[model samples]
Target chain A: MKNQAYRMALLYDFYGEMLTDRQKEFYDLYYNEDLSLTEIAENYHMSRQGVRDAIVRAEAVLTELEDKTGLIRRFQERQKELRQLQELASAAQAANADPVVGDYLRRIQGLCEQLKQE
Target chain B: MKNQAYRMALLYDFYGEMLTDRQKEFYDLYYNEDLSLTEIAENYHMSRQGVRDAIVRAEAVLTELEDKTGLIRRFQERQKELRQLQELASAAQAANADPVVGDYLRRIQGLCEQLKQE
Candidate 1:
């Protein structure tokens, strides 16, 4: 549940460019910069309700893009799958596999790390 | 170069639902059904140019979606990386890794195959 915010942040990363300038600013302030609605309103010389509405609109756009493309869902799925692959590779390497086989398994683990980061 | 058509098909898989029904029909006819513009036009009682235009518009929509989200490109990258992982795992198993390690390596290869299919 705590990662829900992280997912929203990732959605913004994928689709924030499509949002209007004002929405983008307010969303970054509230979500990334961790500013309260009142703080964003004061800084932007807008009402708190306006800031809230803009962020909500940005969220809607991001969610809609994700729904249409399912990119974020696929990304998370890949990450989960990669983690499983990494675990298996690590287990194999720890089992005293042959030196050559260990080297290959190590390479596999490295790729899983890199792919997960991507 | 030949895979260019395959890439477009993958893009359509991700974004074709966003296209209009007509565009989707023409695109499917031209690409998936391997129908020529003339054949699709004859079947739909439209001009060849109309069928071509619809397919192009559908292509533009799919291309835009991919450009905005980079989902298809990312998917391709992951598939390529997983293929590499599969190769590594196969090499490890073939190198006479410990039987237990071989089992794990086999599972990793299986996951790579499954993920690439996804």
Candidate 2:
């Protein structure tokens, strides 16, 4: 479930704008806010089925965009590299006896963290 | 002109899918393929003015998507960071007197180059 949520969050971050306003709102409430379809329907005066349909369609749109562009996949791959670089930096920092080189490794570690956010 | 082409390429890579098929073809021919507007129109049975209009509208769509998403901008910033990381690694390697630390810094430098390609 956590992995599914992470993938959904990344996909939504990349392509959720392609979804309609209502789709966006419902998706946010459903996925990010963890709202039930019935709860969301009641809150928005929508049929539960209607809310379900909207959220499913929105997910489809996000998935289609991701399938075509692979932006999210590319981002995840980049993140993996950043994490590896972070690991290497930590290892290098530990091995390095030079204070100045250690400082540089520390900077590289910080940069990896920042780029992961990107 | 070089800067414009770079920005256009980045924008097109990010959001060109939102454009129509004809618009994509025309944009590729004009900006990437270096075809003149008249040449594109002649090849595609479009009026030169019509081709220009299609291309312009397509450019607008690309630009608007960039404005809203800023994916291209984020990528450019990340590229900038990667370049700086590369420079820092090189400098740190030079400043370090230890052979093992230098080897570590070289690996970090290589990692920076790889991430930049990402």
Tens digits of per-residue lDDT, candidate 2, A1-118, equal 2247777887888777777899999989988899888899999998999998988888788887777667788888898888888877887787788888778888878878888888
DockQ of each: 0.67, 0.58
Clashing pairs in 2: none
Q: Which of the CAPRI classes, incorrect, acceptable, medium or high, describes model 2?
A: medium
Q: Which lDDT tens digits does candidate 1 get at residues B9-94?
A: 88888877778888888777777888889998999899988877787777787887777767777777877888888888777777
Docking category for candidate 1? medium
Looking at candidate 1, what is the lDDT of residue B16? 76
Query: Which candidate has the highest DockQ of all?
Result: 1
True contacts kept of 1: 0.78
lDDT of each: 0.80, 0.82
iRMSD (1 decimal) for each model: 1.4, 1.6
In model 2, which regions exceed 4 Å deviation?
A1-3, B1-3
